[model samples]
Target: MSCCSTSLAAARSFGSVCSPPLTSSLTQMSSMLDTAAEQMMVHKDFQAALDTCDRGLESLANMEQEDSRCGEVKAGFCILGIQALAELNQWHGVLSWVLQQYEHQEKIPAKIMQMCILLYSKVGEPAVMQEAARVWLHCPSNSRVTGFRTVAELYLLHVLVPLGHRDEALELIVGEVGGSAFTEDQRQAALDVVEEKEQQKQEPPLNPSPNSETTAHTSSTQGAVVRKLEAMLRFFYRKLLLTGSGSFSLRKVFTAAVLLYMLFLRLDPAHPSSFMWISKLLQLLKQMWSAMFAPYHQALTHSKGL
Candidate 1:
């Protein structure tokens, strides 16, 4: 059969399966455009591939509602266009496309926003990075998907830190580090900062004042600092439990659990509720650990039996 005839037959079959002509039409167009783009890329005709992606995007723009599948098709086209632009070394073109497609949209998908941020960073466009950061950070924190939140936080820290946005980076660290809004690297960075501060507190002051008033004041200040740190540690622990596996790092989660336990022991020696909370935390940890290792254990048992 001719390619055109086969494509029409496939479209008709898809239309029969997927209710509504509009959805089937969009799906067929997306499939055709994807195939054309892929063929062009295979032939090293990046510009042709880019053109195919543009056509797909135009079709997407004409759609009324952004259904999930349609949105996926659009995102795929955007990614392909960006890749083509990158192949052509047209960084500005990529940025322009991003601005046109996503910058002014009322509701940008988190995945698309992440793609734009990464693309801008690749092009060394700090200004665009800042705008992306502003849009993402201002997004409703409660409504954010945990995975997207984690990526956004990492991108902000990676791109914004060297752009002299230390204050913003620190704000993100404090606000999102303990929550599921951080990757393992970001979590490690936070842990390092906290550990360093803890080590500093443990070290004795270089100069000792003899006056009793000075000693008393110093002790009072140190106590307050310890109390604040302990509170942050507790918050981190609770948030970790509430927002499970944002970065999907079991190791980081285990490290956090251990660190929180240590901090609790050191900081809250006499609290009446300490034992109860610790008991609960231990039980939770046991359940998580078993859940994580159960598959491996089952496989091991089967292998031994064999």
Candidate 2:
């Protein structure tokens, strides 16, 4: 069984059974101290919040011998404490503690990975981010929750980009959510950033002739234009995902997918029927891309004597 499923069963068992004294103490501790930590942190007394977390952990330890639920409570409090420490920018012990706690526990709480991802982000060391990316990539696909995916994306963006690993980053992104999975809007929004970087890298001495600088600048400008269009497309995709109805006709989805395939030829085509939806999506995407690219294209044409 999945660890989440197992943990869910344990939680159910704890809830149904009558609690002994230590169980009662652990429950009380979880309630009282978790709240106090939040309140203290809200008031900007981070140290107090930290102390509350420590106390909460101590209480759970004292109760563990008696309560069947002690292990669960301890895991819960550990996630909360680690998140609090992350907020305080206390990176030194945060990563180790979280990893150790998770490694030993049969299950960490539902949203605990969120805290780990956030803590790693705050630490922002390249080595640490690289490790995080590895964990994110290797974990069972379902191990990724909503927030965890965002963290995973951010980690790759930070670590891979600087290490001259754009191809690796792109491969990871493509494998995780291929073109079909990403809405046209998402692809569009990320386009400029992706294209511009690629363009700058390609700027050449490849043909190191006279006007090499001009050629390089022209390539950079063209890439910037593509990137801008991508950014706008991404904007549209986000809006569609956020606000688009769940009940869109199969026709609409297929049509959109097909249009996406046409627009991004390199992307794998999904259902062939998707081609039918292309006209409508094309109207929207064309306008967005045109607005983004028209000015840049105009300037480029003038510069290149084309």
Candidate 3:
């Protein structure tokens, strides 16, 4: 049999053994495989490409669990898998898979960015295109590789403006590209839209949502907290691994003592009680470090016990 024929049979057989695996484990494995497949794509081997595409499809088939993380992975894999199917002239599969993926993919920004153009072309659906525009406005500013502007333009002209959402469309245009990247002509075009909306309204512009910027700021803070917590846990794990459970030394004790000393610098501005607890924790930590390490240092030189 041809390699493609063998690969297709193997993919089908593997897919049929469908006892559900742990969602987290499956997601991690799928992501690892996806990254490896992406790297392997540089080789441009058709059989490998087919195998990679099949892996994505396999992940997509199992993505319907209640877990959001698994859903996100499935959505991503669906887009990638469909893209591969398209490249191979699997038109019927592409049609079926893209529709299925779109219906179930939870509509995240990255998936929207990945599949919008092709899906729009294939489906010729204005509503789906508008969704792509909505996602683009809220997508991260740094994600310029997505061509959000182009996607927005397609939706605005072909979908939103024609759907009698010209005013809403204008607001999105201003918010996305007005001040910095937009041309003078583009700015004027948007301003004309605002003026048009103003003529329809008796009052001034409505207040922007209080939580919009706050939500973005809070999201950033949460990301930082996660990173810091991960770093701390890794540090603790490494220390445990290296030190085994036991003891410490003078330099080690001194270093930990210095850390406790620095803890005093982070004073509680709100309450005196916090300061008291801070001092107490520091003292305890210092004592623990000293008890653990000081004897080790003493025994080395003087052969003395704590």
Q: Pick the candidate with the highest lDDT.
A: 1
Better of 2 and 3 by lDDT: 2
Candidate 3 lDDT tens digits, 1-306: 122333233323333233455456665645544553453344535445546655664665665554544554444454445444545555345534555555532244343343444444454455655654565555556235344455555555556654557667777667654433356797677557556655666465588677999988966875674455445434544554456437345336545644664465453537553454445445655655565567667778685442
Ranking by TM-score: 1, 2, 3
Query: Model 3: runs farther than 4 Å from truth?
Result: 1-24, 45-65, 89-96, 102-110, 118-154, 157-306
What does candidate 1's lDDT look like per residue over 1-306, in tens digits? Answer: 012233223323422343344456576766756564554445767778778877877877887877656655666666666666766777566656866766553255555556556666656675665665565665665336534665556455557654655556556666653354765686677656545555676688888666979878866875675566456545655655566535356448656756775675574536653554455556666765565567678999999999
* lDDT sort, best first: 1, 2, 3
RMSD for each of the candidates:
25.5, 24.3, 21.4
Q: Candidate 2 on 1-306: residue-level lDDT in tens?
A: 013223333333433344554445765865755464454445656556567767767666555364446655665556555655655667667656665555632134434544454455445655554664455545565344444455445545556654556766676556654332344565455544566677788888565588878988977874675455455555655554455334256336644754665577442236543343344456666664565467778899999995
> What is the C-alpha local distance difference test score of candidate 1?
0.59
lDDT against the true structure, each candidate: 0.59, 0.54, 0.51
Q: Which residues of candidate 2, in runs, are more than 4 Å off?
A: 1-23, 35-39, 58-76, 86-89, 104-126, 141-148, 162-164, 176-192, 200-306
Model 1: which ten-residue window has the lowest total lDDT?
A: 1-10
**Candidate 3 residue pairs in clash (backbone atoms < 3 Å):** none
